[model samples]
Target: MAAGVARSDDLRREPVLPPGFSLVTLRESGDAFGHAQAIAAEAGAATLVWVRRFDIVEFAVVLEPDAILAEARLAHYLAMNALADALAIHSPPERPLLFRWPDALTYDLGLIGGGRLAWPADCPENQVPDWLVFGAMVRATTMSPFQPGQTGVGMAEEGFEEVDAVDLIEAFARHLMLGVSRWQEEGAKPAARRWLDRLEKVTGVRHGIEPNGDLVATSQHGVERKGLVEALAKVDWLDRESGGPKL
Candidate 1:
């Protein structure tokens, strides 16, 4: 796939987008995250790159943060919470939408998909990078046969047959806008709190998201922190060979 934003001159042909945002649709084989990151410097901000695929909702957005990279990395939490909230809105009211630490998303205890973040590799931690790319994918349909003990589910398999990929992408955009506004108005704590709420709770451990997006767990053994950047480098839900969620 070409590593750049899809030509935006055809904005008139794009779907209705939220204010300050533009859409760049890609073919089924495109990689939304890579394209967004590749052209992030020229795309400016609020450019949403989406891949048209029947079995998954794959998309990425370009962001230009005002804060330093150290502080801005926390925005990953906002994006995660927004994604979870978007899924929750269309999911069954009783269905539990949970998060696995920094990125993975789960529904009713079954693996769904998750979000990812990318910035310039050479960018300093305390400096503001020119752009940040947040990408996410949700399994919409399972390509494989259902096993006797499968632990993963697609949106269609989870009773959301009527909700298509476009619906989820639009929902994510709207929710992400709200999340960004909340962070702008009240700071990162609100987003962090929301993320912590959805995080899979571990008994006897106090969970918190550090300023740099690390996952912190405080217990009787003092404190432990997991680097969000490191965790993001290896997405647990993805199958490297298939370039899709693990089946």
Candidate 2:
């Protein structure tokens, strides 16, 4: 698998996670997504890997779904919905939180971070994989000097002064659990609708998430679909070398 920056081996204190979640906290330089992937199979479901950093809220969780890989990927939408919902819980009211298609998250028109999903490479699409990993990163504080044309904003810079990394992770976990329950009891429609409602809208186009997790856009030109798996494989928001959000 293509990986990110190699982080230091220094470990950090663990945070109090919800029931069924086992936390593995890494140092500031460690990559939560990468670490989670490395141990996903043996770590079992609900194993959460978190990176301790002052500038970013980075974490990933392991999931074992009963559905086939194709349909199971729709869980990504649930994860995104839960994430956006978590941010909304703490964000200042009226701050617009939006998603840039399959992955990236934006706050007030500025990029914050995004989510990513991964499964076993050898697992067949028709079979339910042994595990799936969902990871997300949110910019809590800006490490670089801001430029005039900068396109991203940190949580701190957006009136989320009281929110911290732990708070976001906790909220995300609870919301994610709620999303999963809703998916199980009420079906995927609720999760799908939550995601679609927050998607960046185009005036002339109508957007919807397919049952298999693809994005379908309808317009005068007819309908177009984008594969969720293909887009996730590219992980547009990740800086391959840095193992962090794109700057």
Candidate 3:
């Protein structure tokens, strides 16, 4: 189910990923997520699509799960958890890293890039899909002029002086491997717990992750279930005009 490299550019150093992980390197202007979705079938599992750039860290990976599409969608949470874990590895002590429910990642109360998932369009909800792509981005530095009092922050602004785009991608790959292994061995609970813990705290509300990746919120009023698929349909953290995370 694995072993392939779609492409590699000469400018950037090849990423040091784990065994079975192939790389597809793109130029700065390329789209990591879309490219991975486009080439997932040929690339097979563990093929990481990386966009070479200085202002942002962009990457995505192909996954082939035994479970059906709905169940496999839980991989989104696992990806997000691994992303946060990777950031934490090089973060300043006690830096606040969080997620905005289904897909957005937040750092120190500011919006950063988040995770996105894709599957073959023809695949049924109950059927196993040929491939799934989990993609993500993080602002390594502000590509545009910074505005005062804005809620968006880049890694440089948050005291990550020693980290770079390659560092993040390499870290995320390692963390991703660990997360997937834990989920496969123990169950979704381990991954779910880590994902839930990183969620921004909601006043007086306790959160639970449903087996199918739904968000179960239990507060004083009652239990409200937010469908994972629906929530990920429109990403609130993304800024369409700028083509990046909202500022």
Candidate 4:
């Protein structure tokens, strides 16, 4: 179910989003993605549902696209691209922010968080759905002592002194605008290349996204494919107990 939402009454200031975007702020425990999915029809396009918390940055954006859900799911890549740019805006020089496609964001190879997608349950892949939601969660601060062999990290602990949950959210919105414009002007190639650039460099390998949003890799051996739909169902980086990225 969608969680309850309010505006600036609970915030010092609302996120600075582009003109077409609106925000619904949720309390710490609220599920931004679920809420955005639930109210997509009425809330409409570019509605960003954000969970206010200091320990982790969590939010979801509502999208109303004309393409069928299968094709429209590529918006997930666009969201990740924007997120990469957002973190870069505040990251220390040379801090490597990496991504594992379909879903997973890492910093210096440690799991920080990633993204998720949700659409109408009854919507058919062949039909244009009412909306799609791309939700992202990033660990903002560590609340517990670090354990040996742990691979998760919070932004602050990694020298991201200038980044906070709210700041990153605002930056993401700004970059998303450029992503949309780039998609309009140059087609998917530009966005796909940007997303591809951040992955671990592999020699003799090439990557691309298919029209249906599959992750495709071509190498001297052969071509391999991964379905976006199936991949989205697996939350490999999520730590269910803490409701944050895996550690």
On residues 138-194, what C-alpha lDDT tens digit does candidate 1 reach at each position? Answer: 887676557878887777777753566666777888999998988889998899998
Q: TM-scores of the models, in the given order?
A: 0.91, 0.91, 0.92, 0.91
Judged by whole-model lDDT over C-alpha atoms, candidate 4 comes out at 0.82
lDDT of each candidate versus the true structure? 0.82, 0.82, 0.83, 0.82
Error of 1 at 54 (Å): 0.2
lDDT at 201 for candidate 1? Answer: 85
Task: For candidate 4, list the clashing residue pairs, or say none.
Answer: none
Ranking by TM-score: 3, 2, 1, 4
What is the Å distance of residue 109 in model 2 from its true position?
1.3
**Candidate 4 per-residue C-alpha lDDT over 1-247 given as tens digits, one digit per residue, 9 for 90 to 100:** 0111222342456778889999999887898888998899999999999988767789999888777887777888888999888987777768688888768998888888899988888999999989989999988766666789989887767777555566788899999888988877776667777888887657898888888889888999999998988988887878778788888
In model 4, which regions exceed 4 Å deviation?
Answer: 1-11
For every model shown, the clashing-pair count is 0, 0, 0, 0
